[model samples]
Target chain A: MKKRDHKECVSALLPVKDTLDLIGGKWKLLIIISIWEGNKHFREIERSIPKLSTKVLAKELKELEMNKLLHRNVIDDFPVRIEYTLTEHAKSLKTVIGTLHSWGLTHRKAIFEK
Target chain B: MKKRDHKECVSALLPVKDTLDLIGGKWKLLIIISIWEGNKHFREIERSIPKLSTKVLAKELKELEMNKLLHRNVIDDFPVRIEYTLTEHAKSLKTVIGTLHSWGLTHRKAIFEK
Candidate 1:
């Protein structure tokens, strides 16, 4: 490839690398999807993902918050309920997440049926 | 959520879980994109992705092959050239990868600008 093309390739891929570093894990996207699908409370998120441990979920939640994908809201009612919601930044991931979901279905079918 | 909705949610997420298990790492997608961008040789691929160790690249290549995303070819030449190419199955990841690239750019700007 030409030097200019090579530079463009690297530039395009750097953000991809950054994105993967931020969300590359077994549980992070799953947790994000759960919250996106309305599992706002901790227990609800846990129940939605059948095999994820509470410890892992908690850790991933903190990471997502740090990355600004989601945030914590504490409702200081009589019982002090805390809920998680996707930030607008996180909501922007809907298209990416949706594409993953679609490709994932196709990938699964290709693997299992072949 | 209703019981039916919960079931649909779990079913929708299982393949995503599978997808993540197949490609969730710092290096796999990067390596895939490198090859997709025409860095077919091992060394070329290595050069394209900065800071990626040879051992990790080799491992990720094998894993991607195992998942049917890519394959290895050995050309019959004096020195025996080897090249990696995306399977049609892997090429299907183009949109997914592109979405990731776009979202990653947006994500990087969001975090840095705020």
Candidate 2:
């Protein structure tokens, strides 16, 4: 590749690498989806995603919070309750998630049709 | 969660899970990006991705091909040259990749500003 092309490729890939670094796991996006779909509490998220253990869910949620994708809120009531909500930054992932969801549906249909 | 809500969550997660199953790793999307950016040869891709090993690259390439995201073309020359190209299906990931790339840029800026 030419020096210019190489530079371009590097520039193009930097953010992509960063994005993957943020959301490249099996559960992160799903967790985001779960919260986006209105499952805010810990138990709700846990029950929503089948096979995701509490340990993994907790870890993923903390990471998501740290990244500012979602924020955690604690209710001061007779019984303390926590809610997870997506930030605008996280809500921006709707396009990415929608594209993946649509592509996945097509991919699944193609595989099954074969 | 109510019974209806549980069923809705399951339906919503199925395709997302399938999508993750297809492209969950650190390397697959990068490999696709590498090819899309004009790194068609094995050595070019390896050179472009700073830390990718040959073994991993080869494995990713095969998986991408098997998933119909790309195709391999062998040129019948004095010493056989192999070229990899993205299929239409793979090209469709542009929106997905673009979204990630844009989000990544913002995400990186946000982190640095913190």
Candidate 3:
């Protein structure tokens, strides 16, 4: 309605926007999470998260690799193993995940009480 | 390849899932950030975030209200005024938002360096 400037907040908002754009969906973050928790193989990640289908997991994994969030490894073993691991850049999500974990636990209790 | 248990991490994952489900999009968190910065009126919020269409903003506002993350107030005047504000429950997201902000900043730098 009136002419006002939001430029002051833009510097603060852009990075958060990037963060959301990168990890905004349910599967992307959960996939990184499964790998973070030690599930490397495709099947292990799918099994760890209930309701995540193979198609979605495969897609998210590829996207994460493209984004350089994870490394898709090919081990030439007797059976040939493929594993996924978080890159250094992605390991930086440790704090972000820890913060979400704490808030999520508290939020669950708060929601039920409402 | 191997049979292993991911059961131990379920406690950690569910709340994170809840967190992701609640605030996984670019608009929702940005909307809250705009409100947190004192943009109350619909127009004020609309102008604050770039590339956010009226359709998306309106839809996000309703969803946020449904989730009890914010309150919508209507004031009767010559021109009816509607304002949006975060609730106490949503205020608890302060830590989550802060964490993301820091991580996002770091992430942007890491991305460019690669």
Give the top-scoring candidate (DockQ): 1
Q: Judge candidate 2 at residue A33 and give its lDDT.
A: 90
DockQ of 1: 0.64
- Write model 3 residue lDDT over B1-114, tens digit each, in one string: 311244455546777888877787769889998899889999999998899999999999998898889999998896888988899978989888888888787786566556
Query: How many clashes does the backbone of model 2 have?
Result: 0
**Candidate 2 structure quality by residue, lDDT tens digits, A1-114:** 222234544556878888888888889999999888889999999998889999999999999898888899998896999999998878888888888888776775564355
Taking the true A–B contacts (Cα pairs closer than 8 Å), what share appears in each candidate? 0.71, 0.69, 0.65
lDDT of 2 at B84: 96
* Per-residue lDDT of candidate 1, residues A10-74 (tens digit): 55578787778777878888888888888889999999897999998889999889888889999
Model 2 C-alpha lDDT versus the unseen true structure: 0.82
Worst 10 residues of 3 chain A by lDDT: A1-10
- Compared with the true structure, model 3 gives a TM-score of 0.89
Error of 3 at B17 (Å): 0.5
Candidate 1 A-chain TM-score: 0.87
